[model samples]
Target chain A: MIRIFDIAAKDLMQILRDRKTFLFLLIMPIAFTFLFGFAFGGFSKGVSDPRLPVAIINQDGGDLSLRLVNLLENSEVITITQDAAKTLADYEKLLTKGNLAGILIIPTGYTDALLTGSLPPLSLEANITQTAGTTIQSEILAAANRLTSAVQTALIVGQTSSAFGPAFEQALSAWDNPPIRIESTSAVVQTGPKVSSQVAALAQTSPAMMLQFAIAGLLTCGAVIVNERKTRSLQRLLTTATRRSHILLGHYLAIFVLLFAQFLVLMTFGQLFLKVDYFRQPAATLLVAVASSLCIAALGLLIGVFAKNEEQAIAFSLIPMFLFSGLGGAWTPLEYTSATFQAIGHVTPVAWAMDGFKNITVRLLGFESVLVPCAALAGYAVLFFLLAAWRFRRVSE
Target chain B: MLQNAIEVKNLHKAFGDLKAVDGVSFEVAQGEIFSLLGPNGAGKTTTISMLSCLLRPDEGDALVMGHSIKDDQMGVKSVLGVVPQEIALYNDLSARENLTFWGKMYGLRGPALRSRVDEVLEIIGLTERAKDRVGKYSGGMKRRVNIGVALLHKPQVIYMDEPTVGIDPQSRRNILDSVVALKNQGMTVLYTTHYMEEAQELSDHIAIMDIGKVIAYGTNAELVKIVGQMDRITLTINAESGRVLEAWKKVQGVKQVTAQDGTLTVLADDSNQVLPRLFETSALNGVRITTVAIQEPNLEAVFLHLTGKALRD
Candidate 1:
C-alpha cells in the first residue's frame, strides 16, 4: 500500500513538473468555456434585457387579452416581441429561427371565455424537450396562475361589493409582491435576433468542459505507464518488492487524484463566476466528481497500458476524449440532439457524469438525483480498470 | 551443509524461434561477486531479467536467497535489488526523489526511507546534486543515480547489468569501487559485462556466454587454466599480416593464428619457442613486426580457446 502511494506520488510529481499540463488542465477549459458559452448564446447577464424572447399572437383584441399581454411583457423570465402586421406564419418562422423562445397564441374569445370562468386552453408553441422551453412554460404558468387568482378573488369580493373591477385590479397588483417568494436564477436566456446556438447556461457547459478537458489533460498522466516502459523504469519497478497489482493501483490512484482535482477547480470556477451553483447540492456534486474521476482515471490507465509510445498515448487519449465528449453530450446538451443520439449518449460514462452534475445545477434536484448516475460512472470505472489490468499484464509479458 | 546465496537450475527463455536465454545455470556464494561475461547478444540481460522477476523463464527457475523465482516472485524480489542495463531512473525527478521513491517501493518508510536515500546518495557520490533533476545530469551522473536507487534498499543480493556501459573511465572506476564496497558489506553482487578486463578485475566467479549458453564457468585462475601451457602474443606489423599468415601457421608451437586491424594474434604452446619462428616467418614474407607483447592466458584467451574466437568478437 505504501508502495502504491509512492508510485502515485512519483507519477503525479512527474506530470506536474511539466508546465504544459496547465494549458489543458485549467487555461484551455476556462478560455473555451467562456468562448463557447458566449458563441452559443449561453450567457446574457449584462444585457439590456436578459429575458428570453417570445412572440405573441393575440387574436383576442379585448381588454383582458391586452392586460394579459402587458403581464407577460412585465415578466422577468421572457420578453414579448409582438408585430401588429405579422401573421401566425411569421411568428412561427421567428420561433423556428430561434429569434423567439416560443410563440403565444391567444384565441379571439380568450378574454370572454376566461372572464366567464370557462378557463379556455391557450396554445403555446415551444420545444418542450429543451431547457428554454421548460423555462418559458414555467413563466407562462406562473402568470396564468396570477390572473386566475385575481379573478377568483374578485368574484368572491363581487358577491358582496359592487366595485368588482377595482377589486380585481387590487387583487392582481397584490401578486406582484407575493408572500413567501422564491428567488431562483433560471439557466435559460434568449435574445430576439436569430442565434445559431441553443447555448443554455454555464451550468451545462462548465461541467461538460470539465469532463472533456480532464481527459484531454490526461495527455500527460496517461503517458506515465508508456514513459516507464520506454525508460525501462517499469521493468526496474517490477524487480522491486512491488507487485503488478501495486503498480496498477498506484497509477490508477494518481490519475484519479489529478482528474478529481481538475473537476473541483472547474466546479469552483463555475460556482463563483458563472452562477452554476455547484454547491447548492454540494454532496451530489461531489459524488459525481468522484465517480467521474474514477472513470476517467481508469480510462487514462487503459490508454497508458495499451499505448506503445508517447505518440500512441496521445492518440489513445485524444481519440477517446472526442468520442466520449461528443457521444456523452459534453459538447452540447443531450436535449439538443436527436432522441436516438441522446439514447446512445448514455452509452458513454461522460453522459452519466453530465447528468449527475446537471441534475443538481440545471434540474435543481437533490442528492438522490445523482445516485444512479454515480452508480453508472462507477460501473464504467470498474470495466475500464479491469481492461487496464488485463492490458497491463499483456504489455508486461 | 552450505547454501549458496543464489541458485539456478537450467533457466531458459525464448523469443519466438530465437532462444534469448537458453538452458543456463550457475550459483553464487554469500558475499561473493559473480560476473556474467559475454558479448552484446549473449543473453546476460535476459538471464538477469528472469532472476530479477521482470521476465518469467520458459523452462527453468532460479532461487534468490532461498526464495524460488518461479513460485515466490515477490519474495525473491524483496531480497534482490536490480540495476538495469539502461538508465531507468525518471529524468524529471531529482536524484533524491527517485531514490526516495524507489526506497519506499522496497518497503522503507518515513525517517528510514529518507535516511536510506541520503545514505545511497552519499554512496553513489551524488549527495551534492541530489536535488537537481536527473534530466539535466551528465550520462555518468545519471548512471550513478541508477546505481544509487538499487542500493537504497540494501537487499541481500544485487544485480547490475553493465552499469558502466556508457560512462567515462572515472565514473566506471567509481562504480567498480562501489561494487567492491557492497561486497565488503556482505552483499552478494551479480555483475554482467562484456568487457573481459572488468570481469578479470572484479569477479570471484566468471561465466563466459556465447549465443545464450555459458561456455565456461569458473574462477579467474580456474578458467585461465583451461588454456594451460598456452600463451597469447599480439604483434603489430608495419604491413598487413595477410601475406605472412600462411607462413605463421606452418611454424612449430603455433596453435592458431588470426590477424585483425593490421595486427597478428597468435596462440602458441609457448611464446618462448614460437617468437623466433614467427620472426623468421615474418622476415620471409617481408612483414616487419613493429611491436610484440606476450601475455599469459586470461579469460579472453579462455573464451578464445573454448570458442575459437576473441571474447570481444
Candidate 2:
C-alpha cells in the first residue's frame, strides 16, 4: 500500500509538473465549455423560429390581392419587401449576391380568381440558385400552402353555416360544404412543469459537459504515458521495485484525479455563477462525475497501451472521444437526433455518463439512479487497467 | 563462501531461435566492479538484464544477495539498483524530486528520505541545480541524476548498463569517478560496456563476451598475460634501412619486418631473441641503427590476440 501511494504520488507530481497536462486538465475544459455553450447554444435555439426575408412583386391592382399581401406581412414568419422595380431578373442578381432569400410574384389575375371562384394555378417563384435559397423558397411555399388551406376551410364553413354566409357568398358561396365539420381547436398542452431558464441552462451545462471537458485531459494522459515509454522512463522504473501494475495504476489514478479536479471546477462554476442545483443532491452529481472520469481515464489508458507513440495516441484518442461525445449528446441533445443514432450512442460510456448526469441534474435523482452507469464505468476501469498492465509488462520485458 | 554479492549459474535465455545468453555463469564478489565487455549484439545486455530481474532467464539460478531472482524476485529487486543506458530521469521533475520519488519507492520517508536526497545531490555535485527541472539540465547533469536515482535506496548491488554511452568526455570521467567512489563505499557493481578501455580502467574482474558467451574472463593482468610473451619492436636505422630490413627478414623467429623512411618495424613473437639477432644481422650488413623501442601490450592488443579483431571493430 505504501508503494502504491508512492507510485500514485509520483504520477501526480509528474502530471503537475507537465505544463501541457496541467493546461489540458484544468484550463482547456473551462475554455471549451464557454466556447461551445454560448456559440452553438444560441444557434440551436434560434432554429425553431422560422423567419425568412421575402420580396413580393404584386402586379395585380385588386383589393383581394392586396389583402393576401397584408395577411402574409402580418404573419411573424415573412418579412415582405416593398421595392417595386426589383424585377425577377433583379431579384435573381440580388440572390446571387446573397441579398435575398427568394421572390414572390403575384400575377395580374390573382384577385379575379379569389372573387369569381375561378382560381388559376398561381405560381410562387423563388430563387433556387443555392441549396439554402431553395430550402427558404420551399418554406415560403409551405407558408403559402397553409394560407390556402385556411381559405378553403373558411369558404366551406361559410357555405354550410348561414351566419358567415354573406361574407363568404360575397367571396365564394358556389363551393360545396364539406361532409365533415373539422373543428380545429388549438390546445397548448404543457409538456411538464415549466423549469426556470437558469435551471434549464444549468441542465445544459451539466456534469456530462464537464466529462466532455475532462476527455481532452484524458488524451493528455495518454500522451504522457506514451512519452514516458518512448523516453524509457518507464523502463527505468521497471528496474526498481516498481512493478508494471504500479506504473499503470499510478498513471490511471493521476488522470482520474486531474479529471476529478476539472469536474469539481465545472461544478463550482455551475453552482456559483450558473446557479446549478448541485447542493440539493451533491452525492448524485459527485458520483456521476467520479464515474465519468474513471471511464475516460480508462479509455486513455487503453489508447496509451495500444498507440505506438504520442502522436498516434493523440490522433487515435480524438476520434473515439469526439464520436462518443457527439453521439452521447455532449454536442447536442440526443432527442433532437434520430432515434436510431441515439440507440447506437447508448453503447458508448459517454451515453451512460450523460444519462446519469441528466438524472442527477434534470430528474433530481439519487445515487441509486446512477448505479448502473457507475458500475459499468468501474468495470471499464478494471478491464482497461488490466490490459494496460499486461501490455506494460510485455513491452518492458 | 567468497561472499558473492551476485551469483548466476548457467543462465540460458533465448528469444525464439536466437540464444540471447547461452549457458553463461559468473559471480561478482562484494565491493568489486565486475564488467561484461562485448561488441553490439554480444549478449552482455541480456545477461545483465536477467541478473537485474528485468527479464526472466529460461534456464538459470540467479542469486542476488542470496535471494533467487527467479523465485524471490521482489527480494532481489529490493536489494538491487539499476542505472539504464538511456538517461531515465523525468524531464519535467527536478533532480531533488526525482531522487525523493525513487527514495520513497524504496520505502524511505520523512527526514530519512530528505537527507538521502540531499546526500545524493551533493554526491553527484548537483546540489546547486537540485531545484532546477531535469529537462533544463545538461546531458552530464541528467546522467548524474540518473545514477543518483539508482543510489537513492543504497542497494547492495548496482547495475550500470552503458551509462556513458553518449556523454561528453568530462562527464564520462565524472561517471567513472562516481563508480569508483561507490566501490570504495563498499557497493558491488555489475558494469557492462563495449569499450575495452573503460573495462580495464574500472573493472576488477572483466568477462570478455562475444556471441552470447564469455569467451574469456579474468583480471586485467591475467588476460594481458595471454599475449605478454609476444611483443613488437620498431628500430629506426639512420643508414640504408632496406638492407637491415632484408637481414631482419632472414633471421629466424622474425615473423615479419618492413623498412621504410630509414626505419625498421619488426613483428616477432620473442622480442629479446629477435632484438639481439637483428643487431648481429645489422652489424654484418653494416646497417647503423638509430633508435629501438619495445611496445607493451594493452587490453586492445590482448583482445586482438584472442579474437583476431580490434576492439572497436
Candidate 3:
C-alpha cells in the first residue's frame, strides 16, 4: 500500500508542477460555468417571471374581437406585441427572429359569427420550438375558449329575453362578472422550495460545465503515464518489488482524488458566490462527485494504458471529452433537447453525473433520490477500471 | 559452499525469426564485478533484462540470490536493482524525492526510508542539491541520481546497463569509479557496456558477446591469451603510403597487416624482432613512418581474432 501511495504521490507532484494543469482543473471550469450561466440569464437577482412575447392582430374591428384582445392583454404569462403585423408572412419574420413567440389573428366576421351561434376560424402562428413558446400557445387557446363560452351564454340569454343586440351585450357583461366560483379544498403540499428559472439555469450550467471540464482535466493524468513510459521509469518500477497492481492503483487513485478535489472547490464556489443550490443536500452532492470522479479517472487510466505516445494520449482524451460532454447534455439541459437525443445522451456517464447533481440542485431532492444515478456512475467506474487494468497488464507483458 | 549471486543456463529469446539471445549462459559470483562487453544490438541489454526479471527467457531461467526469476519474480525483484540504459529518474521531482519514492517501492519505511534516502543522496554526491528538481541539474548530476535510485535498497545484485552512455567525461568517470567502489564494498555487480575500455578497467570477469552468443568468457588476461602469443605494431604513415600495408604483409614473421586512415597495424609473432624488417619494407615502398608503437594481446585483438571484425564493428 505504501508503494501504491508512493507512485500516486510522485505523479501528483509532477502534475502540480505544471501550470496548465491548474488552469484546467480549477480555473477553466469555473470561468465557463459563470460564462454560460450569465449568458442564459442565470445571474438575474429578481424573480424570473418569464413572460412570452406574442402578437395579436385584430383584423375583425368588432366589439367581440376587441374583447378577445383585451383578455389576452391581461394574461400574466403572455406579453402582447404592439407591432400589428399586416400579414402571416410578417408574423413569421418576428417568430424567426425570436422577437415574438406567437401571433393571434381574429377574422373580419368574428362578431357576426358569435351572434349567430357559430365560431369564426382564428389563425394562430406560433413557434413551439421552446418551452416558453409552447406555454404561450396554450395560454392563447385558453383565452379564446373563455371568450367563446361567454358569447354562447349571452346568445342563450338574449333568446330568453326576447331581445337581441342590447340584451346580448348586457348578458356578455353579466357573464364576465361570474355569480358562482370554485375554491381549492385539498391541503397544500410543499415539494421543496421552488427557484426562479434564472436560478435553475445557473444550477444546470454550473454543474454541467464543472463535470465537463473535470473530465477534460484528466488528460493531464493520462499524459503523466505516457511520460513515465517515455522516461523508462515504468520499466524501472517493474524491476522493483512493486507489482503491476501497485502502479495501476496508484495512478487511478491520483486521478480520482485530484478530480474530486476540483469538483468540491467548484461546487463550493457555485453555492457560496453564484447562489446555486449545489449544497442543498451536501452528502448527496458529495456522493455524486465521488462516484463521477471515480468513473472519469478510470476512463483516464484506460486512455493512458492504450495510448502509445503523448500525441495519442491527448487525442484519445480529447475525442471522448468532446463526444461525451457534448452528446451527454453537459453543454445544455437535456430537457432542451429532443426526447430521442436525451435518451441517447443518457448512454454517457456524464449524463448520469449531471442527473445526480440536478436531483440535488434543481429537484431539491434528498439523498434517497440520488441513489439511482450514483449507482449507475459506480457501475461505470467498475467497468472502466476493469478494462483499464486488463489493458495495463497486456502493455506490461 | 559458495553460491553465485546469479546463475543462468542456455537462456534463449527470439523475436519472430530473429534470435535476440540464443543459447547464452554465464554466472556472476558474489562480491565480484562481472561485465558483458559487446557492440550495439549484441543482446547485452536483453541478457541483463532477463536476469533482472524484466523479461522472461523462452527456454531458461536465472536465479537471483537463489530465487527463480520465472516462478518467483517478486523474489528476484526484491534482491535486484536495475539501472536501465535510459535515465529513468523523474525530472520534475527533486533528487531526494525520487530516492524516497523508489525506496518505498523497495519496501523501506519511516526512519529507514528517510535515512536510506539521505544515504543515497550522499552516495551520489548530490546532498547539497537534493532539494533542487532534477530537471534543473546538469546531465551528469541527473546520471548520478539515476544510479542512486538503484542503490537505495542495497539489493544483493545490481545491474548497471551502459550507465555512462551520453554523458560528459567527468560524469562517466564518476559512475565508473562508483561501480568500482560498490564492488570494493563487497557488492556484486553485473555491468554491461559496449566500451571495451570500461570492461577492461573494471571487470573481474569479462564475457565478449556478438550476435547473441558469448564468443569468449574469462578474466581479461585469460581471454587475451586465447589469441596466442602474437604482438601488435601500429604505424602512422603519410596518406600516399597506403600501399605500405601490402608491403608489410610480405615482411618476415608478419601474419596479417591492415590499413585504416593512413595508419597500418601489423599482427606478427615476435613483433620486436620484426621492426627492422617492417622499416625495411616501409622504406622500400617509400612509406614514411610518422610514429610506431607495440602492444601485447588484449580483448580487442581477441575479438578481432574470433570474429574477424573490430570490436566496434
Candidate 4:
C-alpha cells in the first residue's frame, strides 16, 4: 500500500516536471473554452437581449394571431418560436429542463378582439415562482403595452377606412413591418426546447473542452507507463518488494490525480472567469468529475497497457480522444442534434460525463440527475480498468 | 558446507519453443560473486529474471535467503536487487529522487529512505550531481544512477546483469571496483556478462551458458583446466579469415581454430608445435599473419575448447 502511493507520487512528480502536461491539461482547455464560449455567445456580455425562450401554439392561425406571433418574434425581451406540436405540457417540460422560460398561446378569439381595436387576452404561461419566469412577466407586460399602442393606432385608422377589418389588418401589418425598415442587426433569438442561453455560454463549452482535453492529457499521463516499460523501470520495480497489483493501482491513482486535477482547474476557470454555474451544485459536480476522471484514467491505463512505446501510446490516446470527443458531444452538445446521433453519442463515456454535468448546470437538476451519468462513467471505468489489468497480465506473462 | 545465499534447482523457462532458460542450476555462497557468462541470447538475463521473480520459471525453482521464488516472489524480490542491462532509472527524476522512489518500493520509508538515498548517492560517486535529472547526466553517470537505485535497499543477493556493459573504461573500472566493495560488505553478487575478462576477473564460481543451458560451472582455475595446459594463439592476418580457416583446421597440434572480428584464434596443446604449421598453412593460403600472441589457458580457451567456438559466439 505504501508502495502504491510511492509509485503514484513518483509518477506525479515526473508528470508535473513535464511542461507539456500543463499545456494540455490547463492552458489548451481554458483557451478552447473561452474561444468556444465567445463563438456561441456563451459568455454573459457576449449577448444582448438574450430573450427568455418561449414557444407559441397557434390555436388560432388568423391574421392577427400571425401578426402577434411576428410581433413577439421581434420582442426585445422574449424570443418566440412557433411549434404546432409544443403543447402546454411540452412548455412545462422545457421550463423544467431550463430550456423554455415561458409559453404563449394565441387562442381563436385573438383576431376578433383585435378587430374591435382592444387588447386581446393572450395567455403567457410561466412559473411565476422562478426568477426567469418573473422577468418574463415584465417583458410580457411591455409586449402587451405595444399591442395596446397598435390597437389605438388601428382604432384611429378605422375611422378613415370605414371598415374595422381592413383597418385592423393595416395596423397589425404596420406594427410588424414598420414604415421605415430599420434593419438593425441583432443577436439571433434562440428559442424552443434547448439549453437556456445563460447556461449555454460557458456551461456547454467548458465541460466539452474539459472532457476533450482530459483525454488529450492522457497522451502525457499514459506515456508514463510507456516510458517505464521502455526504460525498463517497470521490470526493475517488479524486482522490488512491490507486487504487480500495487504497481497498477499506483499508476491508476496517478492518472486519476492528473485528470481530476485538470477537471478542477478547468472548472475553476469556467466558474471564476467564465461565470459557469458548476459550483451551484458542488457535490454533484464533484460526483461527475470523480467518475469521469476514473473512466478517463482507466482509459489511459488501457492505452498504456497496449501501446508498445510512447509514440504508440500517443496514437492510442489521440485516436480515442477524437472518437470519444466527437461521438460524445464534447465538441457539441448531444442535444439539438438528431436522435440517432444522441444515441450514438452516449456510446462514449464523455457523452455521459457531459450529460451528468449539463444536467446540473444547463438542465438545473439536483444531485439526483447526475446519478445515472456517474454510474455509467463508473461502469466504463471498471470495464476499461479490467481490460487494462487483463492486458497488463498478458504483457507481463 | 558454507551457507549459500542463493540456491537453485533445475529452473527452466521457454518463450514458445525457444527454451530461453533451460534446466539451469547454480548456487551463490554468501559474500561471493557468482557470474553467469554468456553471449547474447544465452539467457543470462532470463535466468536473472527468474531468480529475481520478474518472470516465473516454467519448471523447478530458486530460493533467495531460503524463500522459494515460485511460492514467495515477494520474498525473493525483497532479498534481491536487479540492475538490468538497460538503464532503468527514471530519466525525468534526479538520481536522489530515483533512489528514494525505488527505496520506497523496497519498503524503506521516512528518514531511512532519505538516508539510504544519500548513502547510495555517495556509493555511486554521484553525490555532487545527485540532484541533476538522470536524463541530463552523461551515459556513465546515468549508468551509475541505474546501479545506485538497486543499492537503496541493500538486498542480500544483488543481480547485476551486464552492469559494466557499454561504458567507458574509467566508468567500467569504477563499477567493477564498486561491485567488489559490495562483496566485501558481505553481499552476494550474481553478475552476468558476455565479457570473459570480467567473468574471469570477478567470479568465485562461473557458469557459462549457451542456448539456454549451462555448459560449464566451476571456479576460474578449474574451468581453465578443462583446456588442459592448452595455449590460445591469437593471430591478426592481412588476408581474410575465410581463406585460411580450413587449411589451419587441418594443421597438426591445432585443437580448434576460430576466426572472428578480423582475428584468428588457434587452441593448441603446444604453441611451439602448432605455430609453425599454422604459419605454413597461412603462407600457403597467401595469408600474412599480422600479429600473434600465445597466452596460457583462460576462460576464452575453456569456452573455445569445450564449445568449439568463441565465448563471444
Candidate 5:
C-alpha cells in the first residue's frame, strides 16, 4: 500500500509545469464547444430554413427566363448570385475552393423549348466535393423541375382555351394551387418522458458530447505516462515504496479533474454564448459529465499502457477519438443520420453520452433514460482501468 | 559465522534458451562495499535486478537483509535503493520538484519532504540549479539527480549498476566520493562496474564475474596474490640486442624470453635472482640497457592472468 494523495500531488505539479499539456486539458475543449455548437448543433434536429448559397448564369435573354431566375432568388433555400460574366470555368473554380455549392445554367434555347413543348435537359451542375453541397444541389434541382412542369402545364392549358373556357379555367385554377403541403405534427417520441419541459430535452443535450471527446483526446494524461516510461522515470518510481496502483490512480485522478473542468467550461459556454438549454436538469447533467469523464480517463489510461512512446500515445488517442466522435454524432448529431448509423454510434462511449445528454436536454426525459448509457460508460471505465493496471504491472515486472 | 547484508545461492535465470545468470553465488558482509565486476551481457544486471526484487529468478533464492526476495519481496524492496545505468529523472520538471516527487513516494511529506529535497540537492551539489528543468541539465547533472532519487528513501542497501559509464572524469570522481560517503554512514553498497580501477578503489570485497558466474571473489589483495608468484620485466637497450636476450633466457626460473626492436621482455618466478644474472649477461653481450622496469601485480594483471583478457577489453 502507498499514499495516493502524495502521488496525486506530484502528478498535478508535473501537469502544471507542461504548458502544452495545460492547454490540451483546459483550453482545447472550450474551443471545440464553440466550434461544434455553432456549426452542427442547429442542424441536429432538421433545419427548417437553410440558407444555401447558389449561383445562376442566365444565358437566355428572355422575359420568361428572367422571371424564372427571380423565383429561384426569392426562395429561402437559395441565395442566388448573379454574375453575367461567370462561365463554367469560373463556377468550377469556385466549387473547388468551396465558395459555391451548385451552378444553375439557363441555356439560350430554354425559352424556345418551353414554348414549343420540347424541353431540353436543363444542366444543373452540383459541387460533389462535400456531402452537404451535394444535398443542396439535389434539392435545388427538384424545386426547379417542379416550377418548369407548372409552366409547361399552363402553356398547354392556354392553347386549348377556345375549345373549353370554363372547364379549362377550373383546371388551370386547380393546377395553379401549390402542390407541396407541409403539416407540422408534434409526435413526442420519448423513451422516458418528463413533464416539466415541452420541447424534448434530448435534442439540446446532444451538443455536450462534442465537449466530451475533445477533452478525452487532450495530450496531458497519456502523453505524460508514455513520456515517463520512455525516460525510465517509471523505473526510478518503482525503486521507491510507491506501488504501481498509486501511480496509475494518480494519473487517473488528474485526468478526471481535468476533464471535469473541461465539461464545466463547455457547458457554461454552451448556455451563455450558444443559448443551449443544457442545464435544464442540473443533477442529470452533472451525473452525465462525471460518468463521461471517468470513461474518457479510462480510455486515456488504456492509451498510456498500450503505447510504447508519447508520439504513439497521442496518435492512438486522437485518431480513435476523432473517428468515434465523428461516427458517434458528436461531430454532427446522430439524429440527422440514418437509423442504422445511429445504432452504430451506440458502440462508442461518446454516442452513449450524447444519448444521455439528449434525453435530459432534448427529450426532457427523466434519469431513467440515461441509466443504460451511464452504466455502460461506468462499465467501460472499470474494464479500461483494469487493463491499464494489468499492463502497468507487467511492464514494471 | 559472519553476518551478510546480501546472500544469493545457486542463482539461475534463463530468458528462453539464453542463461543470463547461471548458478551464480556470492555474499556481501554488512557495511562492506562489494562489487560485481563483469563485461556487458555477463548477467551482473540480472543478478542485481533479482536481488532488488524487480525480477524473479527462475531457479534460485536471494536473501536481502535476511528477507527472502521470493517470499518477502516488499520487505526487500523497502530496504533496497537502485541507481540504474540510465538517467531516469523527469525532464519536464525542475530538479527540486523531481526530488520532492520521489521523496513523497517514500512516505515523506510537507516540511519533511521539502527539507529532504533540499538536503539531497545540497548533497548532490546541485542546490543552485535545483529550480532549472532537468531537460536543460547536463548528462552528469541528470545522473546526480538519478542517484539522489535513489537515496531519498534512505534504504539499508543501495544498488548502483555502472553509475559512471559515460560521465566525465570530474563527475565520475564526485559519484565515487558520494558512494564512499554513503558507505561510511554504514550503508551496504552493491556497486557493479566494468572499470577495474573503480572496483579496486571502492570495493572492500570484489567478485570478478564472467559468463554468468563468479570466476573469482575476495579482497583485492587476496585476488592479487594469485599472480604474485610470476614476475614480468621489461628492458629497453641499444639497437640490436639479440645475443643479450639469448643469455637472459638461460637464467634460473626465467620461464620465457622475447626480444623485439632493442627491447627484451622476460617472465620469471623470482625477479631478485633473475635481475643479477640478466645484468651480467647484458654487460657481457655489449647491450647497454637504457631502462629496466619490473611490473607489480594489480587488479588489471590479476584479471588478465585469470581470463587471458584485459578487463577493459
Candidate 6:
C-alpha cells in the first residue's frame, strides 16, 4: 500500500540520517569480513600452494629410503626438511614447538628388510594436534605401499620365470613401470555444504560478519521504535486512518531492506575484491541473503516491541545478538565444532544461512543444493515476523 | 435539531484498580470548540483517547461523525484528527517529510497529499522552514509542525489533547487561534487542557474534569455564576493585630477577615463599597494602610467554589 511505503520511506530516511547505523550496516561488517578473511588465509586458495614441513630421518641411506624421500618431495603435501639430520629427540622438540608436521624415521637396512620380505621397524614422530601431520602420515603410507608391491612383484617374477639375468632385469623394470595398469577414475564430489581453502576467505567471513552486524544493526531499528513511542508518534498514527498493520509493515520493510542491502553490498565486495565466489549462483545467494536479513530484522522488531526505553532496547538487541551469533557459529565454522555443538548451533538461523553460503562458495553447488538452508531461514523469518506483528499490535492497541 | 459531531456516553476505562475514565459523558455540537478542562492526572487525555478511537472504553462507546469508536474504529479515525500532548514529529525528518507521511496515512495521495502538506506547512507558518529537519528548529517550531501533521487530513472533528503543553507563549497563542479558526470554518473540535485560562478563552462549552469524572459542564458565563458575587481585598497595614481584624469585620458588607503578618484580607459582598469603610475603620483603629488591592471573581473562584480546590491545584 502507499501508506506502507510512506512509513517505510520515513523510517529509512531516519535510519540513513543516523551515522552510527551507517557504520554498523556497511562499514563494520565489511571491515570484519576483510579482517577475518585474511586472518584465516582463505583468500590464498588459488594464489599459492601451502605445504607442511616434515623431517625425513633416513638413517637407512638405502635406495628405498632415497626413493621414499623423493616420493615425499613430489607429493606436494609435505616438503622434506634438513632437520632429518638431527636426532629423534631434536625432531620431537620441533614437533612440540609446532613448526614440524611429522618426522619419518626410516631405520637403517630398511631396503634390505623390504627385499627380504621382512616388515621394517619404521617410526613416524608427529604432532597430531596439527591436521597436516595426519595428511603427511597418509602420504607416507601410500608411498610405502607402492614400493612394497613393486618389490614383491619383482621377486615373484624372478622366481617363476627363470629367464636369463638380462631378461630378468628387463622384466623387473617392466613390472615397476607396468605395461598395463589398473587406471583410476576420479572426480571431486562435495557432500553437503563445505568450505575449502580454495574458497575465498571472505566466503565464510563475509556471511558470518554480515549476520553479526545485521543483528548489531538492530540498535538503529530498536532506537527508532523506542523514539517513536516516546514521542507518541505511534499513538498518533493510530488516530489516523492507517491500520496498525500498516505501521508495523512500514517498520519491518525498512529493517528488512536495510539489512538485505547491507548484505548484498558486503557479499558483492567480497566477490569482487576478496575473490569469494558467492556469485557462483547469484540468484541462490540473493535468496539466502534476503531470507537471512528478514529473519534478523524480524527479531529486531520483536526486541523493539518489547523494550520500553532506549536502554532496554540496546540491551535487548545486544544480548540476544551475541548469544545467538556465538552459539550459532557465526564466529567459527560449525563443521569444525563437536557433533553435539554443531547440532546446537543449528538452532540459530545463522548456521543455516552459513550453510547456504558455503554450499555455493565452497562446494560450488547449484541452486537446488542450497534450498534446505534457504527454506529454513525463511521459516525462521516467518516465525519471527509473526511474533513481532502480534507484539506490535498488542503494544499499539 | 443541530447534529452532534461526537457523542460520548457513560465511557469508562480502568487500569488495574484505578479507574482512568469513569462513566464520563458529554457531547460536542457540530462546529463548536468543546474544551475538557482539568488539572494534571484528571483523565483529560484518557477521555480524548477513547473518543479518538485510540483507547477502547471498558463499559461504553462514542460515535464520531456517526461512526462508533468501538466497532467502526477505522471509520472514526478517518473522520478525526488527534494532536497529542507530546510533540510526536520525527526529529530526523524535515517538516515537509513528516507532513507528507502523515498525510498519506490519513489516506491522501499523489498531488492531493503534496498540496495538503503545503497547505498545512503554510498554515503553521513554517512553509519557509519546511525543508529543514525538525531537530534543528526551535521547540515552538517543532510544536507547530506537530499540530501541522494532524491538520493535513482536514478531518471533520479534531481532538487536541493538551496540544499547547510545554511550548512557548507565542506557539500556544498560535495553536489556540488555529483551534478558533477551525471552529469558524465549521469544523468540530474537542480540545483538552489543564490550563483554566485556555479553556475560558476558547471553549463554547467547557467540561471541568477531576478524578476521572466530569465535575461540571456548561458555558463559561453559566459556570461562572456558580459562585455568587464576592470580592477579596488585601490591606497591607503598618500594624498587625487580631484587634484590627475584628474592627474590619465590624464594617458593612465585610463577611470574613483573616490577618497574616501586617496584611489583612477581607472577603466582602461589594469590594468598592467596603473599601471606603475599610479606610475609615483602619484610621479609627490607628492601623496605617500602606497598600490595598482587590481581586475579581473568575474561573479560579468558580473552580474553588465548585470543587473546594483551586483550578491549579
What does fnat come to for each candidate?
Answer: 0.94, 0.78, 0.92, 0.94, 0.78, 0.96
Candidate 4 ranges with C-alpha deviation above 4 Å: A44-198, B238-250, B260-262, B284-287
Predictions' DockQ, in order: 0.62, 0.45, 0.59, 0.59, 0.44, 0.61
Model 2: per-residue Cα lDDT over B1-313, one tens digit each: 5499988899999999999899888888999999999887889888888887788999978899999989988898888999988888778788988898888777789999999999999999999999999999999989999999989889999999999988999999999999999999999999999888899999999988878888788898888777655576768876877667667888998766755456566667878887888888888888777789886666655655666555653
lDDT on C-alpha atoms for all candidate structures: 0.83, 0.72, 0.80, 0.81, 0.72, 0.78
lDDT of 1 by residue, A61-155 (tens): 98877877889999866778888999988876666545566777777887787676546556777765544565677777778677767665756
- Considering the two chains of model 1, state its CAPRI-style docking category: medium
Q: Which ten residues in a row have the lowest lDDT in candidate 2 chain A?
A: A184-193
User: All candidates' TM-scores?
Assistant: 0.78, 0.71, 0.76, 0.80, 0.70, 0.75
Better of 4 and 6 by lDDT: 4
Give the TM-score, chain B only, in order for the candidates: 0.95, 0.81, 0.91, 0.94, 0.82, 0.84
Question: Model 2: clashing residue pairs?
Answer: none
Residue lDDT tens for model 6, A193-286: 2233545455668888888888988988988998898888999988888888888888989999889889888888878877778887989998
> Ranking under lDDT, best-scoring first?
1, 4, 3, 6, 5, 2
lDDT of 3 at B91: 81
Which stretches in model 3 have alpha-carbon errors above 4 Å? A45-196, A366-368, B233-252, B257-266, B270-295
Error of 3 at A103 (Å): 25
**Per-residue lDDT over A35-148 for candidate 5, one digit per residue giving the tens place of the 0 to 100 score:** 544454342453232234566778886766776777777764456777878777886666444355566677787777656554545555553422333444545555655666
Query: Per-residue lDDT tens digits of candidate 4, residues B1-313?
Result: 4499889899999998799988998888888999999889999999988888888899998889899999988778878888899999889998888888888888888898888888888888889998888899988898888888888888888899999888999999989998899899989999999999999998899999999999999999989888887999999999789999988889888878888789899888899988988888888888898899989899888888777778773
**B307 in model 2: Cα distance from truth in Å?**
2.6
Pairs in steric clash, model 3:
none
Candidate 2's iRMSD: 1.6
Candidate that beats the other on TM-score, 1 or 4, i.e. the better one: 4
In each prediction, how many residue pairs overlap at the backbone (N, C-alpha, C within less than 3 A)?
A: 0, 0, 0, 1, 11, 0
lDDT of 6 at B141: 91
CAPRI tier of model 4:
medium
